[model samples]
Target: MAPAITTLAAAPELSAANTGFMLICSALVMLMTPALAFFYGGMVRVKSTLNMLMMSFISLGIVTILWVLYGFSLAFGADSGSIIGWSSDYVGLSGIGVTELWDGYTIPVYVFAVFQLMFAILTPALISGALADRVKFTAWALFIALWVTVVYFPVAHWVWGSGGWLFEMGVIDFAGGTAVHINAGAAALGVILVIGKRVGFKKDPMRPHSLPLVMLGAGLLWFGWFGFNAGSWLGNDDGVGAVMFVNTQVATAAAMLAWLAYEKIRHGSFTTLGAASGAVAGLVAITPAGGSVSPLGAIAVGAIAGLVCAMAVGLKYKFGYDDSLDVIGVHLVGGVIGSLLVGFFATGGVQSDAKGLFYGGGLEQLGKQAIGVFAVLAYSLVASAILALIIDKTMGMRVSEDDEVSGIDQVEHAETAYDFSGAGGGASSRSTAAPAPAVTETKKVDA
Candidate 1:
């Protein structure tokens, strides 16, 4: 009999290598939340850029606090109803010993907890892009706090936690295709519906204020995703981890090319925005399939995602939802493309007991994959809408017309993303247009 194409090595009692590797991966994943801030920040108008960044940044602060308090317990604790888990022992991470391994893994429980915390932070941030330029900062903060509690905590349990019903049912979300992307994407759509469209909607020329920032954020997310996907194996120097890493790159490259090609054909220009957005689409699509599909299969997943997501972004125009930065188009749609295709493209050789329809595995995996995808999308959409409505009725969701028109960053954050006031060198004299105080120039826009 042939050996498995991807095989994970049995972990030793305490390999400093694996633990340290996970630690680094955890840090890398942490950086992605801020990188996302830059990405989303650059996409909005200059007036609201700081507000866009704060939306993503606040998630890191809020989710981190909640995760340690009760989020982790509810997400990873011993199963209760196959729906959610709750155990006071795990709450506040009280019972987890310092030297103890996390169940069958080689890393400390804290490493896994922190790593997943990064995910919880990034998921709601992903939703922020959809509701940009309109939401009240206080309302957004309150919404995310409620969101992680009601929506994110339980969804993570269902997909990743021990004894999760999806796990029991054989659904394969190698690393948060359903839990993160689909979950967040659906939630983005739901909240957008409740908050309504940005004031200008289709009439305004809302191009990205800084394409280079978006590109940089895309690069960081691409870099950190290696840890997000390969690290899910929980150990490296293994065949499965290597395969996942390889597939991740290939899929991203393929998706980027496909997206650019589509843009050139349809829009007559291959834009930097398209390239950056394509890379994210590829990353999101391959995330769930990387562990189970071959490198060739990864290309297929990426290419399909690039093309489909490129088209999906237009759904908002036809449907008339705001989706300022196309979160639903890219994440929700890209995640579904990746998750459902896994059932058709999964290979047993690459991953034991994992074979899709094309490999003679039948429709069992496909059926299961669909169930997981729709279930997450449905739950997130409904729950998020309810949360948004409750917040809208009570504290109010949208900023005042004056705040939205005058600028959300100035009103909410008391800051502007740029201060052109210091453009008084040989390149330019002190122009009257430069008003805000110039603090510093942190990054150069190559794009």
Candidate 2:
């Protein structure tokens, strides 16, 4: 029997309420994947919009199956020295259906298992934003499978599993500040480096094709994030409720103001793109510290994330890497800001016993947070790079230039997102609707 099982058997009263609450939280978290689809779908060129949506939506299917098969076992199974999980509990999900209590909470183990499965589904999909336009669909599907197995599973073990080094070291990641955000962010940077810039990256004025779709995505993400962060508490207690509610408002208001303010100052316009990006940045920043800090801390986290991510998104210009949709800028940068800030803002004055640098706890907490950050970054980057290389060498990761230009919707999926109802011979209608920009005038930085 696993150690957690033994401990759980000793204290059965702690399982029921927690398990029920977590089950609901897990379902809420799952909705974000579709929300992500809409968010990314609207950002790409119209020709590839459907393709982008598929990229995010497909993960829900692929990762869900894998999580049941072996992903969960590798992540939360019995520990093997904190580096990875041993599948001694392989497919032992058979007995998990029993009404058992664990961790001083009474709930079926299956509830916890499914809750975590939603996260596994979303993490790899987040990286898809970085490689949006050029990658082959089959290649991406295969890449995520291998990437999750090699990178995500092990890292998750280190942070959440029993006997994991980070867990034993007292590193606090409240949700997935490092595991999901930073890990995806660094991996995005690595992939974009290996893949090179997208066609017409800096020179093409790649405006979002649909602002409404972007707003739709933002709304879904906001709604689902409550489950993502508060669910970490794994119970329906007052603490979880408070965290969920506060996380909702602080992130929204902060991002809305920050994005508009920055746009007015820099570009003399407040674009919808800025609004969507800022909201996501705030959400990312608040994720790690949501449960541990006060409302004020949440606002600070959101404001800083919005501003820092906005600045970081421009790095693609100077550094010349095409993070197609700013996954690295928003998720990775925001995640780091939140994680580090929590070190100084976790004033236990609110609920927990933890305090931050400004709260008179000194740099001890900050040091620990930094260490956790580095360890996660190093592991994720190296592991993800190897996974990418192996997948590239073994199968290939990109599509042909002709296929890309023709659009993955028609070429890859054998379908199109729209049809002009046979009016004006299709060709004339498309050409007349909007003339393609001349080669010299393409806006690359916004792509």
Query: Residue 349's C-alpha lDDT in candidate 1?
Result: 80
Off by over 4 Å in 1: 1-12, 426-447
Please give the CA lDDT of all the candidate structures: 0.91, 0.81
Against the true structure, candidate 2 reaches a TM-score of 0.89
lDDT of 1 by residue, 148-240 (tens): 999999999999888889888889998889999999999999998898988788998999999999999999999999888888888885578
Best by TM-score: 1
- Candidate 1's TM-score reads 0.92
- What digit string (tens of lDDT, one per residue) describes model 2 on residues 400-441? 888877777888788877776775756667777866777866
Poorest 10 consecutive residues by lDDT, candidate 1: 424-433
